[model samples]
Target: MNTDSKKINTSRISISELMLPSHSNFSGKIHGGYILSLMDKIAFACASKYSGRYCVTASVDTVDFLSPIEVGELVTLKACVNYVGRSSMVVGIRVISQNIQTGKIKHSNSSYFTMVAKDDDGNTVAVPRPILTTLDEVRRFYDSLRRIKAKKEHMEDTNSFDHTSREALDRLSDYGAILTL
Candidate 1:
């Protein structure tokens, strides 16, 4: 148990104050887009390091803004490589807004991003990703896995119809059907 605890602590990566612009917004609050941009950059870095290849955002499951981040606050973005697929990786990212003066911190946003590893040709490639080395890492890994699994299942439930008007037109063309009178 002691060994496992040590591993979990090492997996936690906290990045601080990459961006907290006081002049960026009129209300002195960091824009939602700004936070997202920072998260994307950090998440991309984490995924790219794990995959050892170029990675692109496949999807951002959810990015809920719980509170506003004021200017001059230290916005800390924490991320970890949670899971990996054949050519895909998922990263868990959290943004904590900390007031520099008062030292009050609040979770401003939390999100998971799916990234696809790509080769030099921009084609998807398989790469080694992070493994759950400790209990905390395992827990986060499972959570991300569950989220992806749920998303996949939910996607499957949607209509799989691939019918397109262009294909319909091609099919009708064989009948000499220019019946647009």
Candidate 2:
């Protein structure tokens, strides 16, 4: 067990920007890629703050665009370090857009980014453990642990799966198409 622990609140980061036309798609709504860029930026900041070292994104999970953001709205991205392992931290990001005139806000996106701490030579480095200060923070840590377990199970299943097994072929038969072989 690591003796060092850092408060979750110390790793939180938030940034808000006005959605401009240049950030939108042809349909007059903010582009998903643009939102993802902001998410990555905030995730990096949050993880770096928590780890006290340079961090790089290992994987991006659960990027769900809940609603479309209008071009003239104010978009905000909030990120926090939800979980930490020896060298990795899970950064949870929530994105919301508010209509400045009407004051109506909508949840536009939520995502999780796994970042790994790195040293000056680009080698992985260990990060301090998170000190969960509140119930909500504890719950977030549990959720991240669950997600990590599920991901490992999924990878194990995928690695051992036989895609062309009789059972798999039979399942594909539900498409109402005949198999060539």
- Candidate 1 structure quality by residue, lDDT tens digits, 67-169: 9887777888888777777888778888897777787889898998898989999999976634455687778878877887899888886656343556766
* lDDT, model 2, position 73: 99
**Where does candidate 1 stray beyond 4 Å?**
1-13, 18-26, 160-181
Give the count of colliding residue pairs in each prediction. Answer: 0, 0
Cα-based lDDT for every prediction: 0.75, 0.93
TM-score, per-candidate, Cα-based: 0.76, 0.95
* Stretches of model 2 off by over 4 angstroms after superposition: 1-3, 176-178
Tell me the lDDT of model 1 at 38: 83
Candidate 1 residue pairs in clash (backbone atoms < 3 Å):
none
Q: What is the lDDT of candidate 2?
A: 0.93
Give Cα distance to truth, residue 25, candidate 1, Å.
3.8
